[model samples]
Target: MDLSSQNRRQVLQTLGIATGAALLSNTVSAKNAVLKAGPAFKYALNMSTIRGHRLGFIKELEVAAKAGFTSVEIWIDIFQTYLKNGGTTAEAKKIINGLGLTIENAIGFAKWIADDDTTRKAALKQLQTEMDQLAQIDCHRVAAPPFGATGLPLLNLDILADRYHAILKMGEQSGVIPMVEMWGGSENLKTISQVLYVAAASGNKNALVLLDSFHIYKGGSSVESLALVNKNAIKVFHVNDYPAGISPQKISEPDRIYTGDGVTPLKQILQLIKNPDQPVVLSLEVFNESYYKQDALTVAKTGLAKMKAVTAGI
Candidate 1:
């Protein structure tokens, strides 16, 4: 029990404590660094999966938020219904913000590519209104599908490009970007090549094309074509699957199924989209009528689960 022996023991104890602290700090720092790198893609709900459930616009937001989804794509009709119920755009934005959800895009049908001048004018007017409404809620993206010409003959690609450029300019003026959506059943712009012609011919670098797995297959276009476009050209991608046994021509939007439930090569498609600058948002957009029969929360949770499963490796 000499003084020197006691001092030596105390010094050893202090050194042990110091070494442990240093190791703990280093471990935490390394773990945090890995987390900062994050995942390659973000997930979002398209709201169409629960369309049969009949939840109001606000309720839909609640369902998504409760199900752990941070992003959602809304249909324009749902927003209009909210307005009819005396809900203001500011209030809608507040509800979404309070729930910690972001509106990634809105589904809209603006026939901006119609050959008729009068029809085109009305479609442009509708676009302006929809874009303005979207801007109020701080959502700057809208889906521009060829609603009027889906069943008609395919229009000239060059003319469609001019129309796309014009609409993109209009969207720019209102701080919104109208993404040219591809419909598999549509007569025009059904293939990746056709969409590329319009998007490229638009001569606008910010031009975007909305893609869906179902539509891509329905249109008889190869899924591999997605690799040809720059990743930046696609802002939002709709994720869904269809039964392998069904012919692509026979499948409709209602036949859409949850991701990974069918035979769609989603993993391969994800590999094709190589954008290092930013993570692309994968929105689940299924119109399966059967999903509507389930409770809204269950449907949302189920959809989110399937989405996570398909993108787990990516």
Candidate 2:
């Protein structure tokens, strides 16, 4: 073959290789990029830890925003303070959106399931009102105990599921989801089996199950149970650790610690439920009083870093 013809063939081959390499780079970036837990399922420190000391809602929000959490969980009381302080729901929305953080879920402590008809109806109405605020603030989930007075006896679950469904139906209409938290030391859905039973019985499309590592560990749940849970039904995980001395029989909720500070198998739990299709927000829901005394911003950043490292091995 002539030298010019050979050179032309070589140039064409190099151009084709370059084009393929560019497409592969784009594909990797778009789809299979090591899926860093990113802000998607990244840590969100619950503002409740600093509640009493921080008193004002906006002040606490400032702490979290400055801490760089990119997401957070605000309890009902904090949100009420925001509204009362002339912070309109729209204003709260703006504050969060401007900081590029999302509200993972609102902790509205209401007992939607009760033995009495009156209390139950009242709770549902109250939940609807709360949902209205949650809707305004761009939150999609509300966390609550399984339908009784705060930390009290659960209503007949058979009876409770129907009532819970009413709340779920309300959520469906309003575009919010009721994520029932696994309370650490409660007769109502204390174990994974019980939580599953209640969720299955609800039969509502909007029913969401919230997982908290501290609560799950305190409740004496097995790691294998994590594998069995319906990943789709899980909206978020409150990552924290419980001390070993706490009795499952006791009413005391364990003073939760940071992710790696305790024995919770956070990585194993992650591997069990690492469904790429499902989006999960890992929230730092530590109820520890000690951490509250430290700078809330430092606590938030530290908690996120600990979780990031824990999930790295998985």
Candidate 3:
């Protein structure tokens, strides 16, 4: 059947439209799959909760795994010490895998926000070292607290953003993401707004923020502020409560209590940050001195139980 030139052009245009529509649908589906939430509550324990027990890296992993925690965060210092004492990442990965647990994130002081140029260089170098170790264990997140900037007046947020982007770009090469965390006592970047701005300003699509309940209350930010954050930007949320009696000014690290023992509005907080498709790690981070006196395994079990109880519904 001979067709007119106009008919041929119309058929070609129709095929192009159909092809474009199919491509759009597939793209949307892949993006949605990445954001689709996992289990309503994914529990993770930060090693700090049992730091006083002085458990080794492998021992701590054992404690978390035996306690039924699917995920755990490690401290950079401990992992470094393990290496200093002749430990290997391959060995660590074997132990972690054998126990059926995943390393969710890590805690490190990068000092990347220092006002001094030389200091900033040192911080990034240290951060890359830590990130390299984390990547070996398949961990892709690290906490970026205001380590050196703490108690100092706010530095220029724009400068901070640029510095953050620098490390984030390095992370791209190292396969890890640095989470700009809030420190309630910090003189800089202590609030959700400040952290979010730095992250957004970095212009990296992988920018993320780490939230801690204690820091939120300590920094004098209301729990409601969490709702303003983009949920995808939160990969790890530190779960701990602070005492009502202690004023924010006087609060210290040792004051952190278990998840439900204190007065933080955790349920409402979770409801705001909880993503249904992507798994948000609820990491237990506490420094209560009393917990250090108990057996490390006991502490791990208790912390995991409390975390589960508070995160019960979603």
lDDT, model 2, position 111: 70
Q: Is candidate 1 or candidate 3 better by TM-score?
A: 1
After superposition, candidate 3 runs with Cα above 4 Å error? 1-38
Q: For model 3, what is the alpha-carbon lDDT of residue 94?
A: 89
| Residue 152 of model 1, lDDT score | 76
TM-score of 2: 0.83
Q: Rank the candidates by lDDT, best first.
A: 3, 1, 2
Write the residue-wise lDDT of candidate 3 on 1-314 in tens digits: 45798899899999999999999999999898766735766799899988888988888888899988889999989998998999999999988999999898999998988988999899999999999999999999888888999867779999999999998999999999998999988999888889989999999999999988888888888888888899999888999987788998899999998888988899999999988767788999998899999888888899888988998876
Q: Which pairs of residues clash in candidate 1, taking residues 3 or more apart in a chain or in different chains?
A: none
Model 2 residue 313 CA deviation in Å? 2.7
> All models: lDDT?
0.89, 0.75, 0.89
TM-score of every prediction relative to native: 0.88, 0.83, 0.87
Best model per TM-score: 1
Preferred candidate (lDDT higher): 2 or 3: 3
lDDT for position 37 in model 2: 38
Regions of candidate 2 where Cα sits further than 4 Å from its true position:
1-40, 147-155
